[model samples]
Target: MKDKTNEISMKKKIKNKAFSLMAKKGLKDISMREIAEACGVTKPVLYYYFKDKEDLCYSLIVEKSVVSNENLKKFAASGASFEEILVFIFSEYMQDISHKDVFPFVIHVSSYLLSNPDLGKRFEVVKEQNFAVISGILEKEYKKGTITKKGKEMALQLIFANLAHLILNSCEHAIKFSPSYPKDMARAILKAIDYREK
Candidate 1:
């Protein structure tokens, strides 16, 4: 019994290592042998966990997309107003940058994979779920007369589009710009979302 559990745990560790490597070098340059080495294992051990490179990439994509959508949903469920919700979402990104280098690549990889129909479908589903959560929050705020907009679905899309742009922009200059990049991006995103803020 314990042996099976240990094997499963070891497999998970290898899979996570592969995802981390993919985030660093990207899918185009990643190899099974490299992934195994990164995980301190042999190429055959990596193959024991995954069929091939494509299988590893797909698994990572599905895991990441699902986890991200879940987090977004939980954040949107907070009783915060539209502006507060926007701030919370942006602030979460600000907080994650230091601890997890792969954080920024989450959206970047999803956008890059938009060209692949299979991956695009998964991305679209996760995106729709995220937007639905945001739209629900916006609808609540609108009902409370905080947001003067009736078209919440459009508003949610715009907010997410702005977020994606902010992430992309910050990532482009994050290394050279140092801490200023994410800070500036957060401010810009907040300003875009809270146009009526006094």
Candidate 2:
């Protein structure tokens, strides 16, 4: 039991350090040795857990994305109104990101992922599965006519696209926009989906 706990703790430590390093150094440019040092572990220790750098990255992506998806599921089940849910998701997700710089780092990693089909597909599958969870909720709302006339496609597109934009704007773009932008955007997104204000 202690060993398992240590394993989980070590993985989390490595992930946090690697993510911070990647955010600053760019994912492709970071070396496994550097990641080891960042985690206070030897290169051989890293190798014992991760087959290679790509494998470690794949695990990171899978683990983080899964957590995001699970959070979405919990929010969906929380019985909050769609608008309330959107506000909470956007506000909380953006605020909870340990480092804003990781957004740009993610974009860099995504470009590399495309060239690696095996990892890319696994990544896509995780994304699609997560989206499906949101999609199911939207479908229910659409049937109830609680959402705007734009329907499922537009709602889904707007919700996720706006999320990406928020992250990028906050991270990559130099402009220091209003702190309220995320919540404001969230409200607007909901309004775009349904004209009737909740």
Candidate 3:
């Protein structure tokens, strides 16, 4: 039992340091040795916990990403109206980014993935799992003729990406935007996805 606890603690240390290293230097630029050093562990110990660099990347995506959770799945699968769902999602996202840790962690993982396309394939399963919940909602609307023939990606991109961009832009570039931007973004996504404005 103590061994298991120590293993978990060491893994957290490795993940935390690896995240910082990846955020500082691009993902490919950082090596296992550097991560091991940051954790004050030997190369063999790091290898025992993670198979390789690819395994570490998978760990970061699968184990470290906070985006995948039962709450998010439940929210997406809720019977709320499309507009309500959109507003709720964007508003929650806005609140999430306001936290000191969550937003930056998301940005780090995202930026790393953006640059390293090859590593992204490992994350595809998790992405598909998340998409399934929202896709069901979008498909229901599509079948009801409430939305155009477009699939779920359009709505996902418009809501998540646009809202995230607004927050990130304000934080990094001092780009001026109204505080109501999240609400407006939800509305814009509604329009883009052809959901009738209410």
Write down the TM-score of every candidate: 0.66, 0.84, 0.72
Candidate 2 colliding pairs, count: 2
How should the candidates be ordered by TM-score, best one leading?
2, 3, 1
lDDT string for model 3 (39-150, tens) is: 9999999999998766886787676335644665577566677777766666665665554444455566677778778777767777776567567767777777777766
Alpha-carbon runs more than 4 Å astray in model 1: 1-8, 42-44, 75-78, 98-100, 103-115, 143-145, 148-151, 172-198
Q: 1-198 in candidate 2: lDDT tens per residue?
A: 999999999988988888778777866788999999999999999998888777787788778778877887788788877776677767765775436766766877887787777777767877787689778878878777776446667878887887676666666455555668667876787667653533
By lDDT, the candidates rank as: 2, 3, 1
Pairs with steric clashes in candidate 3 = none
Winner on lDDT between 1 and 2 is 2
User: All candidates' lDDT scores?
Assistant: 0.64, 0.76, 0.70
Q: Global lDDT for candidate 1?
A: 0.64
Better of 1 and 2 by TM-score: 2
Q: Which residue segments of model 3 deviate by more than 4 Å?
A: 64-69, 95-120, 143-145, 148-157, 160-179, 196-198
Worst 10 residues of 2 by lDDT: 189-198
